[model samples]
Target: MTKFASLKSVRLAGAAAIALLAGAAQAQNSPPGAEMATEAYLRAIQEKNPVLHAVIAVNPHAKADARALDAERKAGKIRSPLHGAPILLKDNIESNDGTATTAGSLALKDNVPGRDAPLVKRLTDAGLVILGKTNLSEWANIRSNHSISGWSAVGGTVRNPYVLDRSACGSSSGSGAAVAAGLAHLAIGTETDGSITCPAAINGLVGLKPTVGLVSRTHIVPISHSQDTAGPMTTTVEDAAKVLTIIAGSDPADPATNDADAHKTDYAKGLSKDALKGVKLAVARFYTGYSPKTDAVFENALKDLRAQGAILVDVKDFDEAPIGKAEGLVLNTELKADMAAYLASTDPTKVKTRTLADLIAFNAAEPKEMVWFGQETFEKAEKTKGLSDPDYLKALADSKRLAGPEGIDRILKETGAAAIIAPTTGPAWTIDPLNGDNYGGSSTTLPAVAGYPHLTVPMGDVTGLPVGLSFIGPAWSEKLLLNLGYAYEQATHHRKPPAFRPTVAP
Candidate 1:
């Protein structure tokens, strides 16, 4: 659950981490006389304010890495910040070692790969140890509209660390819950849209939705080539920056990058404590004025920012989301094609159903999957032609024009600000098995559709269920946003772990 190697790599890539090591040369830097051992990390989990074993302990090797990290720290030769950090990746991502890479379905339960995903490689190269894979919504939560967030056939349902009765949110559900519960310091999460941020927001952690190509999607399972991305989910902006610096890079395997004008770098430099000083920003009040309780929290946050000298501008003109409709069309057209292609690349000899149509048939044969939620999204997708379809081509064109030029670009140009801020989402509602998520306000659809980077920080709490405040900007604005988020996090210090109550009595 910890990202020790990434923690160490923070210094490896940034000025601060190395400086710490430089000043304290020949001395163990984990903590002042800290015990670096498998026992300590396990004890941390054992004594977690809220237990998080279900999401992480299934990975058998997590303990071994903890021991190694402890040994290295004792020897005064820690590999990186995330070296001994126990990290649980979503099951969809490939793990070269012993961890299984099932995408939350029994179908791919044994679909282990021969190599670690490119993102995993970057993390490990930076000294991150792969503890094991955490559970997720089956197939990245793309199956059913009625599908509960965080419920996977393989992992069952991931309960919110705060209130167990509430939905943990989906796809990256385990990552958010595990990190918030102190099972690990950080986790790597993927998102086509709300997967990462939703879980993180509701779990009281930071979620970064990197620009489409900021991190590699080479070995992870896919939904849309246009929107699929991997990012850091952590307790603090500093921690997210620590891991992001390593994973943000160009990858040849993911050709969508050829057209991407993304800014990839060690984004941790933006973690300055005073980043909000005199920084110009716009608040999309449209994303606000949702929940009365959330409004109170947002106003308080605004007061804090104003006091901190963030030149705030009120923006009410943006109901426009770039590539808005185009994004949906793009996903539908791209999914069938991209998924089929990806399925073909896997170890076909072992896979039962490769095509989306095959999956539909399997679901029909097994009533449990199709009883309530059906793959209507998949059926719609399967009916569409390849990326060459005139509709898809137009949608792609519309996406660029709207989400990029008319959307984020226009806003930045009008405000002349470094970034835009809004309510990431409203309060977490009661989890309903008979129904799906009770989402209130969501600001993810904009930057998410534009293929731009977005970072959401836990601004404050709402009725005890965590709600996040979102900050977004043009591509590669990760550093600027990170600095702002870090400054706010340090200023408010709002993050708190969940209490795991069975339910919140309304």
Candidate 2:
């Protein structure tokens, strides 16, 4: 029997128990008002974060930032809806706040960035409080193929709030768990492939993997420039839209975002319960069938979509042969080139390891970081010929073309659909130290590699664990995806706060 099935016997009573516990927890931890005061949120972080291991460091100036925003609001100079809202950031993203931007690795424990990343500046300018930096898989899960998703030497392992022993699904694990556990109003998570959406899905939150370049990646730790972007992870789709609007704009330092201002808008204004009306959505069933419980949840979501006035068209699968074969080559080649550039930009005094080679050597010298997994992926990336190689060029062209124009774009054009829907991923698995992540099915790759927009919303729970339904579209289709996600979220109201269970009891 499958894991989902094995847990079904205890699901009904377990869910009720979880709900009661969650309600009590929330009541005990509730803030003074509708919007949590930044001080109260920080106190909660201090009380709850040790057990959760979600936050790596608390921003020493967060209380002051929140007070400043409150003063602006009282002065009738409110910058945006996010004004005074507490926000957590993934550790890989740099901030001018006193905390170091460690990618959960000890080598950069003192890598305190002098300036905020462009995206961080945009959000702070709009008045969001930088609560703290959250933990992530060391080096964004690129150091080792067998690495634990939420384990890092700096922050230890991030525990799932729903079930403490289960995987939180990195490298956005801490961001997802923090928001779900109400440690903050919102959090920023960076994705390359399933990093953002997978964690969001497993943790029962809304996550958007915006089109690459829509959000500036300047100053973030690099994996692949072709596929990396920071996005919002929130308990509500409306909150995700609000955060996205603030961060989506042109950045002079990042040339890829030169045209971003044209595509940017107040995404929150586009949300409506009737937004799904007259919309044609295609069902991408390719990612289903991994877990029966997940598929069941997805099927019910389709029904909810149809009830919301959406026309659902069935598209079994898209041809993804070329994308799978060339993706590794593109990522490996870019990692060597992009990481060197990012490291070069860091303060030499704060960062001792200056390049990919330097990082590999540092890991070898410090064996504690590799106690659970070897640096096989890093070794492979180090051996790759730099970006100028013919192999790298061919792989990049093939992967992008197939994942974009010939894959997601073709399906939308041929099927006359505005967006496609699929299961974001299966439920969170047991975190195994002996092996690595036992990821089941996932639908993030096509949109991730194609540089398209993908949003995951809480669909339902399977044996007391959360699952997410994904909406994907062509580049710059974030508005459409958010609207659809908002509509579905309203109709179903599937999200439930985590109960912080020890495990799935039988």
Candidate 3:
């Protein structure tokens, strides 16, 4: 039997071995129960977070919220699967519970919007406790090309839970690390391209970037409207699915989400261990072979999939189709327009910097924000013509068509497959303040720009670091992806809790 099968047999034997394994798999904090786990996480945040720097603020109301949820449960009122579960939000997502949504920049330190983002509201409505906000890349890594992945003036650097000195990846770095380290059961992370998947892969977590507009973006900080999305980062596929079920729906305020209510469903309801049986999955080989170790892990994952009765088809050199070249222009144009509109909508007294130009000036005046990286992207964005520019319009249209209809859609059509799979990214590299992030090959761009669903599940480890296998599908295919991920997770059980080591052992 395989090692995972042996573990399953051991777990079936009794509670003693299971308890022992659970203790070993507890990462930085043990999970005794929800309440106890919350307390332990809070304690860890106080004791160990100085070095990890994963959390920017702790919710003073977390305990109270948990208590309220407990009372509701005792009264026989279970709200959802995540009822009473403590969840961390990336600091870019606004919440009204006295925590500021800073987006890891000093300029927005006092910019409390005094309301929860609509997606946040959905999570809260499902009885998930807000455990406070975690740090992210400064301005979601858009302010500077040279900016470090996990560093921000407000939150320092978020360390990888598996290796303290390694990069956590960003701009959802803290959310990934915190969930992997057992700081929280779940976290909400925003992604424009690789922000959610990269960090989730490196930190050994399951991340699901839902179809853009599946979750409302209202009151969340802006990026490119075409590609931006908030997703769930969790330790398990089941938890990610549960969170997605709660958060996915249409919001009247966000016009982009008009179709979401029709698409959203109970994503976790039909998960089965035999989900991959007879399923045809196209393998996107573009990102493979970058690292022999990562490639080996991926090969083993393929073996596991085949063992589970999945039919894999190799699709080499998937057409990127000028998507990369056009992506920057679209983002730059939208960043200038979207950011200015968001800032203007905020309370003027609370957000003094009402435009991207104002933010550029604020950063120039603040030495701490520019200590490691300058705002070159911000400067370029400021110089862009308004969204009416023909170049901007053409770039957006071209990028969407290439990445969506003619790219992922074409691949799916040709392969006659339900989804495409690839390595999410290589393992974490050493954190470098002076040099910034050194990311390896990634499969996040096409699905991200296509506004499609992308799910990453921990495939296995390379050396001592973790890697993930991605499942990308057309829009509103979250349910199909989640089912496949859940099957793979059950078969391999590749995810292990982080040890919080100082570094990889030589």
Q: How many steric overlaps does candidate 3 have?
A: 0
The residue-by-residue lDDT of candidate 3 on 100-180, one tens digit each, is 889998889998778999999998898878889998898999998888998989999999978888999999999998887
lDDT of each: 0.74, 0.86, 0.86
Record all residue pairs in model 3 with backbone atoms less than 3 Å apart, i.e. clashing: none
TM-score result, candidate 3: 0.93
User: Which prediction has more favorable TM-score, 1 or 3?
Assistant: 3
Q: Estimate each model's TM-score.
A: 0.89, 0.93, 0.93
Model 1 poorest 10 in a row by lDDT:
5-14
Q: Write the per-residue lDDT of candidate 1 for residues 398-420, one digit (tens) a residue.
A: 87677777887788889988888
The residue pairs in collision within model 2 are: none
Per-residue CA lDDT of model 2 for 369-488, tens digit only, reads 778888888889999999899999999998999989988888899889999999999999998989988988699999989989999999999877999999999999999999999999
**Local error of candidate 1 at 234, Å?**
0.5
- The reply for model 1, stretches above 4 Å from the true place, is 1-57, 69-78, 257-262, 321-323
Q: RMSD, each candidate, Å?
A: 5.5, 6.0, 5.8
